[model samples]
Target: MLAVKLPSKETIKVVEEPIPIPAKGEVLIKMKASALCRSDLHRYHGKVLFDETEEEANITPGHEPCGVVEKLGEGVTKVKKGDRVAIYLGLGCGICPDCLRGDVMLCKDFQCIGFQKNGAHADYMTIPEENCLLLPEKMDFITGALSTDVGGTLYTACKRLNLNGTQTAVIIGCGPMGSGGILMAKGFGAKVIAIDLDNKRLELAKELGADYLINPKEEDVLVKIKGITHNTGCDGAIVTAGGSTPLNIALNAIKKRGSVALIAESNKAQIDPSNQFIRTLNTLMGCWYFNRSDWEEIANFIVNHNIQLNKISSDTFSISEAEKAFPLFDSGKTQKVVFTWD
Candidate 1:
C-alpha cells in the first residue's frame, strides 16, 4: 500500500508500506476517495493543529475520506465487509458524554484522524466500525469523501445561522468550504452572497449556487452586502477564511440579531465586539466538525436536495500524485483536491 507523507514544510512524499490490519472493534477499509483541505495544508506546512505529541508530522494527512470495508475486526458488528462508508475524523473516548452524544470533537480526549493518526491518504486505512458513516447508494466516492468535512461542516453552519428561503447568507472566502456553504445554503433556499478577493473563486462560487458575488479587492464587502440586502444587512454570514479582515466583514455584514459561523482555523483575530457584537447582540459561533449523530441526516439532506457536493472538489489525484496535489491545493488554485483508488 502507498500513503501520503508530509515530511516537512511544503513537502509531500508518497511511501510504500504494508497494508494495516484492523484491531478489535475496528474495520479495515479499502480506500476509494479522500479529499484535501486547508487544515491539511496547515499540517503540511509543519504546524500542529491538535495534540499529537509523538512525532505527529509523520501521520498520513487525510481526514475527508470514504471507502469500502474489506475486513472487520473482532467485536465489530455495526459495519460489514463491502459496506460503503465515510470515516469520521474525530476519535474520542466512547465513554465521555460528548462522545456518547456523537459530538466527538468536543470530548476532552478528542483526537483528529489525519492529525493524530494514520488517515486515508493511502490505499487502505483502519478505523473503528462505529466511525463508519454509511453512504447513500447513489452518492459517488468523491462526494462521499467530501460529505464528511466540507459538506457536513457547511451544512451544519447553515443550520446554525438559521438560513432559509427568506434569508441572505454571506459566505466569506470562496474556497472549498465556502463553495460547500453556497450549495448547502441554496439547499436550505437561502440567497447566498459570495465574497472573496480572487475573482476566479468568486466566479466558481456563483457557478456553485451564490446569488451574488463580491470581490473585496474591487469594492467594500460590507457595503456591497448591505446594498444587496437593500440597505438592510444580510441575515447571516459564515467566514471560512482565517484572515481577520474577512472575519470582521462577517461581523459587520449581518443584521443586528443575525448570526455568524466561523469555520476557519485561526490562532487569533482582531474584532470590534463592543458595537459589532455586544451592542448588536450578534450570535457568533465557532463551528468545527459536525456531530456523528448528524451523519445520517446530513447524508439524507444531500440526497434529498440533489446537492452536487462534487462541484466543490475540482481536482483528483491518485495516491502516487500526492506530491502534485498538495502544492495545487496550497496555491489556492483549486478547491478540494482529492486522492482516489479507482
Candidate 2:
C-alpha cells in the first residue's frame, strides 16, 4: 500500500507500506477519493491541533475520504465487504451520551482520524465499522468524500438556522465552506447573499447559486445586505470567515431574532453582545461538524437535490502527487483539492 507521510513542516512523501488489516469491529476501506481541508494545513506546518505530541509528523493527513469496504474485521456488522461508504473522521468512545446520540465529534474522548490516527491519504485505511457512512447509490466518490465535511457541515448549519424560501442567508465567506453553503441553502429554497473580499471567490459563490454578491473590500456589507433584503435584515447568516469583523457583520446583518451559525476556526473574537444579539433576541450557535446521525440524510440530500460538490473542487491529485498537492492547497490558491484513485 502507498501512504502519505508529512515528515516535517512543508514536507510530503509517498511511502510504501504493508496493507493494514482491520481489527475487531473495524473495516478496511479501499481509498477512492479524499479531500484536503484547511485544518490539514496545521499538520503540514508541523503544528498540532489537538493534544501536544512529538508524534506530529507520521499520521496521514486526509480526512474527507470515500471508498469501498474491501474487508471487514471480526464482529463487524454495521457494514459488509464491498459496501460503498465515506469515512466519518471522528472515532469516539461509544456509550458516552454524546456518542450514543451520534454527535461523536463532541465526545469527551474524541480521536479525530488523520490527526490522532492513520487516515485515507493512502491506498487503504482502517476505521471502526460504525464510522462507515453508506453513500447514496447514485453519488460519485468525489461527492461522497465532500459530503463528509463541506456538505454535511453546511447542511447542518443551514438547518440550525431553519432556512427556507422566504428567508435570506448571508454567507460571510466565499471559500469552500461558504461555497458549499450556497448549494445547501439554495437547496432549501432560501435566497443567498455571498460576501468576500476576494472577487474570485465571490464569483465562484455566484456560480454556485448565490443570489447576490457583496465584496466588503469595495462596499459596506451591511448596507448592501440591507438593500438586498429591502431594508429588512437577512433571516440568517453563516460565518465561515475566521475573524471578529466578519462575525460582527454577520450578527448585525440579520433581522431581530434571526440566527447566526459560526463554522470557522477562531480562537478569539471580540463582539458587543448587547448590540449583536442580546437586545435583538438573536440566536448564535457554534457549529462544528455534522452529527453521525445526520450522515444518511446529508448524503440523501446531496443526491436528491443534485448538489454539485465537484464544482467547488479546483484541483485533483493522485496520492503520488502529495508533494505537489499540499503546497498548492497551503498557498490558498484553490477551493478544494482532492486525491483520487484510478
lDDT scores of the candidates, listed in order: 0.90, 0.91
Deviation of model 1 at 209, angstroms: 1.5
Over the stretch 1-342, how does candidate 1's per-residue lDDT look in tens digits? 998888888888899999999999999999999998888888878777786665877889889999999999999988889999999999999998999999999999988888888998999999989899999999999999999899999989998888999999899988888889999999999999998889999889889978999987789887787789998898999999987888899999999898999998888999988999889989889999899999999999999999999988789889999988888888888988988887
Q: Tens digits of per-residue lDDT for model 2 on 1-342?
A: 899998877889999999999999899999999999998988889788878356745788779999999998999977988899999999888999999999999998988889889988999999999889998889999999998899999999999999999999999988889899999999999999999989999889888999999998899888888888899899999999998999999999999999999999998999999987779999999999999998888888899989998899899999999899999998876899999997
Runs of candidate 1 with Cα error greater than 4 angstroms are none
TM-score of each: 0.98, 0.98
Superposition TM-score, candidate 2 onto the true structure: 0.98
lDDT score at residue 258, model 1, on the 0-100 scale: 88
Candidate 2: clashing pairs of residues: none
Q: Model 2 lDDT vs. the true structure?
A: 0.91
